[model samples]
Target: MSGLPDRTDVLVIGGGVIGTSAACRLAEAGVGTVLLESGALGSGTSGTTAGVVRTYFPGNPLISSLAVRSLAAYQEFAERTGTDLGLERIGLLVLFTDEQQVQDFRDTRAAQQAAGVDVELVTAAEAARINPLVDERTVLAAAWAPEAYACDPPAIVRGYAAAARQAGAVLRTETPVTGIDPDGLVHTPAGSIRADTVVCAAGPWAGTVAAMAGVHLPVTTYPVEMLLADAAGSAPRDALPMTMHPSSLRIRSWGDRILVGMGRPGPDETRDAWLQRVSHHLGTTFPALAGQGLEHGWSGNLDVSPDGMAFIGRDPSRPFVYAAGFSGQGICQAPAAGEIVHDLVLGKESWIDTAGLSTARCPGVPAGTA
Candidate 1:
């Protein structure tokens, strides 16, 4: 398209993975969809994600259910859309360092099992057998889910965008949304677009986008640093599951390199500082990778809610306005979120219950209508 159309059936804000997924679903449903992005596609948090797809949210049933559904979606993405996502089934190992943590894991495993998730509570030895790179002293027990996967994030985003474009979704990058009215008028520097419905899938900048529509969303963005380093020495090439530490640090194998990540509060962190911290943490936790030199490090923003659960569903006052606050887990649940947002826009009943994720359920958001 030469310029933004004067009007569209649905205007999707943001071109990250979530926005692209939503746009694809809407377009496939035969809606006139226009996706606007401030920067390049997947340049935000979606690009910087660890790309660990797992259904392991213990206490949050909504997230767990969505994750389970998304796992299936990702596994079938290439088959359904004929787009290669570079999906690798490396599995996920949630480590527990003590007896109490192990018991907690066991309880969570029970809940996950009842929800039809295939997870196994393994001993320290079993965990080591699954991934020998970890320090055995730190693992008392672990929850091993074999279906968890890791994928090429940028490729996945491109796949969604390509599919959306093929399905007749207009994608406009470098077009920032300056303003939005409750009645579906979207303002950009180029021109104004009048949409019948608007959906905001902005990742870390969701709060700012919500304010444009006069709705106050409680979304916080934090800086998260991650590093990529080559295997120290004689590291096994395969059969290593994506590992998570009790400290919330995650490490996964990326071919011959290791991907390490940790979330830090506030906005002040240098790349050098993050490298030092991550190197120390990985060395301390794994021991085998101690003193390994990090090859590269980068930082990205993570959108989070107060309760750590996603805020999804229609706005109370403006029913046509919908937002999805994925809170850093957007990739695994993008398809489900897009479908739910689509359903809400069309006033149809969603297969998945979304009452628990409504904006009204969030703090400081009033229940005007849902």
Candidate 2:
């Protein structure tokens, strides 16, 4: 529908992966749902994600369990949503250069194992055997999770949107939410929607949206960049997994090309300087692909929290729930996020323990709240 409905059971703001996933699950459960997006579905940060789905969180059992659950959801995405996400179970290898990181990873691996993740800490030689692209001289050891996977982020968002529509949810694109009331009223340019429950999944704009409802969300935004280079048959790229280099560069296969992602640059760093740093890291880590087909580079923002973890629960005062501060892991964790939102909306007990993910964990939010 081009126009907004006067009322809904649930009004979801943001058409990214998390919002769409929540709408899908809610509508599937027979709730009257309406989703409004400021732009086309997945046009936001969700489309720009590296789309790596791995169940490996360093010593965080809550996040690790959520990752494992979401990985299973992605593996069964096509069967459930009737859309193939082109999931590539290429696996993931996190390389550590020094002994300190190795020891830290030992603890992380133990946490992951305890959380039921099939991951192992392997030697540098074994890492090279798994993927010859590894620079064994620099990498001391690696954590390998052969079940990790990657997929099309935009496709995943569209899949959930489509499933939500099929299940009787109303989704409107190019509809920007301008105001939100604590009593579950959402205002846009077209009209207003009064809902029993509202969801704030607006990615980086989540804090701004929550503030409109008189809620305090401590989510911050940071810029991230990624470059795509032609693999050029170097180092058997087909056998390569989503590899995390010791220099903090994330390397993965994007079809025949290689995707290299660098974290947020320094506050005063110039674009050229950031590119130079990426070039240096790529060349030093993988010598063969130093200057090969450096085709495309792009930037996006991440919704980060002070704790670097997501807040997924209802607000303590407002009638809206939220799933924000995903940092950069929203794509991999959307499925679990959707389930949590669904449970909150219906007042049902969530299977996953959400005490650590509540908004109360944010500074000044207080305990037993969001």
Candidate 3:
């Protein structure tokens, strides 16, 4: 009783943003919580994220609402913990390429407005004023969300971990979970942790971890790559907005550097070929970033579900097991997802409607749904 206990009320697997945030909330509520991470906190996908936080997700009310709540949580986290989240609310602009896409933007703007998101439809010229990177020659229109922010993912993860520790949660790094049982036994190289409940926030490895517990989760992993470059003459004078292009490429300002990201391409494409493609894309869209020499690059696996939305909630059959499938929005949804996990473990009413987000709602990996 004087030292770390062998048993805890909750055993959280994974030390990423989702796990640490849940641990923070659970410990703040006086639960005996233990969080185990195979590697350092935020060193996985959380570390490689683009770190864009916004409440506009086209037509999804659940994600938008959760994101709105999490933005407030992020601000509170920075204020209370004295942690600089590097939260630059420089806004987000998604450019449309054609009239049909512009109409889609109109519908999306309506949906976002219905969900209480502060979004507006801007002309191509106005979009250029916001980021000065839009290709006015081909742009049809744009959807702007001024409340969005770009943050430091590592700082956010560490902030949650620090708060969890201060609230009495025990966090152990390099303690890889070897196996898990339905009876609440977690096996690790360090030792066994007997828990009353287990929260799986393992990201890409969630499916593997679930199998050890005799459960199957329909989660898949894909490699997503990003590029970084110095903002000497390639970036705007002021902070640039997170710009999403129709080509699925996203570019933003990360301090004095430009961050570029896109979904993974085919295996035949080499890194040099990909960079050339990215350069061409930038030349066509921004023009300012054309031929800009990239200083760094990295890649990480994105844990995605069949429906593209996250699968959050406890398993109906295994009441003690909870899984949070972030689907690449972990940083934006982690704060609220953590609270939802806490509510599930404590048998309390969640702040938002989580009925539709259950894993049971997932259709289980359809043919080729990304």
Candidate number that wins on TM-score, 1 or 2:
2
lDDT of 3: 0.82
lDDT of 2 by residue, 237-325 (tens): 46479888867788887777788888856789887787788888887777767776455567788899889889998876657788989
The lowest-lDDT stretch of 10 consecutive residues in candidate 3 is: 361-370
Clashing pairs in 3: none
Q: Which candidate leads the pack in lDDT?
A: 2
The residue ranges of model 3 lying beyond 4 angstroms of the native Cα positions read 1-4, 230-235, 364-370
Per-residue accuracy of model 1 over 1-370 as CA lDDT, tens digit each:
4878899999999898889988998999999999999999999989767887877775565687888888788777789877878777888888888789877766676677766678888888888888887777777888888877787788888998999999999999999999987677899988899998878888888888888887667778876767787786768878468898887788888777888877763348776776677778788778888888876467788788778777777776674555556777888788888888889888899987778887677666664231
Model 1 lDDT on a 0 to 1 scale = 0.80
lDDT of 3 by residue, 1-370 (tens): 1333589999998899999999999999999999999998987778767888888876676788888888989999899889999888889898888898888767666667766789888899998888886778768778898988988898899899999999999999888889887678889888888888888888898878777876677888978888886675645678889899988888998778888887766689987787778778877888777777865578888888777788777766664555556778888888988989999998899888877777667555322111
Give the 10-residue window scoring lowest on summed lDDT in candidate 2: 361-370
Q: What is the lDDT of residue 198 in candidate 2?
A: 89
lDDT of every predicted structure (CA atoms): 0.80, 0.84, 0.82
